[model samples]
Target chain A: MNKTLHIALSGLNAIDSPGPGVPVARGLREASGFDFKIIGLAYENLEPGIYMPGIADKVFIMPYPSEGIAALKERWEYILSVSKPDVVIPNYDAELLPYIRLNQWLKEKGVASFLPTEEQFEERQKYRLTEFGEKYNIPVPESHSVNNLSELAEKGKHLGYPLVVKGKFYEAGIARSPQEAEDWFLKISHKWGFPIIVQKYIKGEEFNVAGLGDGNGETIAAVAMRKQYITDKGKAWGGITVTDPRIMELTRHFVTKTQWRGPFELELMKDARGDFHVMEINPRMPAWIYLAVAAGQNIPLATTQLAHGEEVKPMPSYEPGIMFIRYSWDLITHVSSFQEFSMKGER
Target chain B: MKINPNLAINDTGFAFDPMTGHSYTLNSVALEIVQRLKQGQTEEEIATGLADEFDADPVIILKDLLDFIEILRNYELLEHE
Candidate 1:
């Protein structure tokens, strides 16, 4: 009989702004050489993944990271009491710090998580993107973190009008003038908080690579995609794999420099002159990760294996032209399930 | 307040409003309150019932119910009386 490994996953809220949990869980289910049960960690009862019957063998609502480590640890202890997971994969940015901090304790309990070193996680932060590029010798767009709204005018003039203004975490808007820059700054600040980024606008094609690193300065798998359809919020609604050796080389260099140990997405932009600049680095898998699995690489599964200290082979190559088009589906579920989960914190 | 006729909420806590074509998921407690409201339960009944049912503090239940009702209104699931 194949031994079943219990795996816990978070970021299951598949919605307009989706999370990476569902795709990661699907990849684990289809993963080669492993039989597993999935435990879903969710923040909201309404997160669609909780209701998706087969994906999660069981689901538990976790305390928000904002509730502080004590509450989070207590929740995890309760979850571990019910089921001992072999490994836990946290798929949200906000939840990452807690998981990373709890890594050693989780290992003491036999749960492993392949995550980046604290320095790696902190260096690649959106606010520190410039430092990342300079340190790694990767080409990155000139960007600065603005502390006050007044700085928008001075920075806009230097970077030229039409610079990109970005929130600390998510949302990026291009401002064509000083007025527009300040307006975007206020909008993004209001939603995502301060220290916004103003970047040299590279009016070019956007491409991304969803990759996994083995923590030994080698990329275990990498797949590049050029977004074909983008939503108003700047997410790829449809995207296709591309045959680009440049992105592969860039990814290798990045992995080698940082010795990054887990899944990551590199957002890049190609200028009119065909030069590519790293736009941002997402510390976790992108929501369109299933596309990489379809093309030829199973990144989420690979990361899971590496998490357990298993030796992994570098994926050979993937077919170009593989594509994914994301769409919304209405999940039909009963209120009782919601009540059971909410009242009991588990379902 | 009344539930929009075009809205359908299943036991799984999945809510759909055909008028807007936007679907939302609800927590278990929130789903129960919505169902209670649909059944024409008064705020007092809901507050008291939820507090008793969940073994929660009454003050917290009252606050939560009001917050959820406001959310329902925002989602267009609640019709203003």
Candidate 2:
């Protein structure tokens, strides 16, 4: 008999640089032996996922995490009383920490979530990546965190021309000269915050691996892909599954070492020397996670199962050469639907 | 000396490498050389055949064939040694 599970997830903004919420919901809906009632949690009224047909069975407006944990908890409490979700998946990086803080509360309320430990999450931060690499014996580009423009210029000069300047939370730009480095510093700092990261840049092809860990040093699922086409915003528009044993080994090594508890994506670069460098580690699934489902490993489904405390055997293999080309669709919806969600915070 | 057995060469002279998912378009001469290579023809045999078919010098055909094979190697379309 199939059991119906209520799964709540966030990150529904399906703009050019999409969020994983829609794809995650799609994967869950495709799972066998489980019927899912997807509840889309949105921070904004027009998240697109709210209006996308059949994507979310119910929609709820969530308070932004910056609004404080008390507000977030109050909102979720109301949601639990009404919807009674079996599991909640937070698909946005900015919201992960807040969700992690609420994991125990959710568990006590009979809602489960799979999230990394606080220590694990902090260890993988962008500024701490070099430290993370050294501790784990992984190869990463030499990086330094700078507080001000002078520090950035000095480190940028030391790292040589064409180095990478990165904001605290997001945004990275390649600065070919110290002048360019200062420009990026001002631009990114104005948007994000202080303490930018200056790192050695390795010119190479990028590869990504989406993986789920069992939280006990076991990799439940992993799929590697290379972007065949990239957008101006550095998002993958078209990608293909690849069979690179080295990348697979790296994924296993990362999972085994960290015992990562949930969905994670590893951004890697293969340099001219054929060596893989750890570029960044995103704490949640990538926007293109549906490709993992198409390639034979349903990562989102596995993650949901793990969160529900079900046993998930390791998915050790997947077919390569599977391609995914993204296309945009114009969804038509009436203004009243948006008004209902905006006015009442539920739809 | 060997091409990937899994490569799909279509009638439009387009080739796809199944291992890496990289695709390329082949010109007429390059397509002929790839087909001959797939048929287990050696460098000298492929050169001789191309020369007779196109009425070109065998020396020039062999030189161009070697260059094309080097490109195939760089693309990883050639099987590993």
Q: Which is the leading candidate under TM-score?
A: 2
What TM-score, to 2 decimals, does candidate 2 have? 0.95
lDDT per residue as tens, model 1, A1-347: 15788889998998888899999998888877779899999999899999986789999999988888789888888888889899899998877888888889889988999998778888988878888899999999888899887787888888997789999878999898898999999999999888899999889889999999888898999998888889999999988887566778898999999998899999988777657899998888999998899988999888888888888999989867677889988898889998999999899
The docking category that best describes candidate 1 is incorrect
Q: Number of the top candidate by lDDT?
A: 2
Which lDDT tens digits does candidate 2 get at residues A281-337? 999999999999999999989988889988899997898889999899999999999
Candidate 1 local lDDT, B1-81, one digit each (tens)? 677656678999998653333568988987898899889898888999988988989888898788888888766577646
Q: lDDT values of the candidates?
A: 0.86, 0.90
Model 2 agreement with the true structure over B1-81: per-residue lDDT tens digits: 778887889877999865566889999989989998988899999999999999999999999899999999888788678
Identify the runs in model 2 with alpha carbons over 4 angstroms from their true place: B5-12, B38-40
Off by more than 4 A, model 1: B1-81
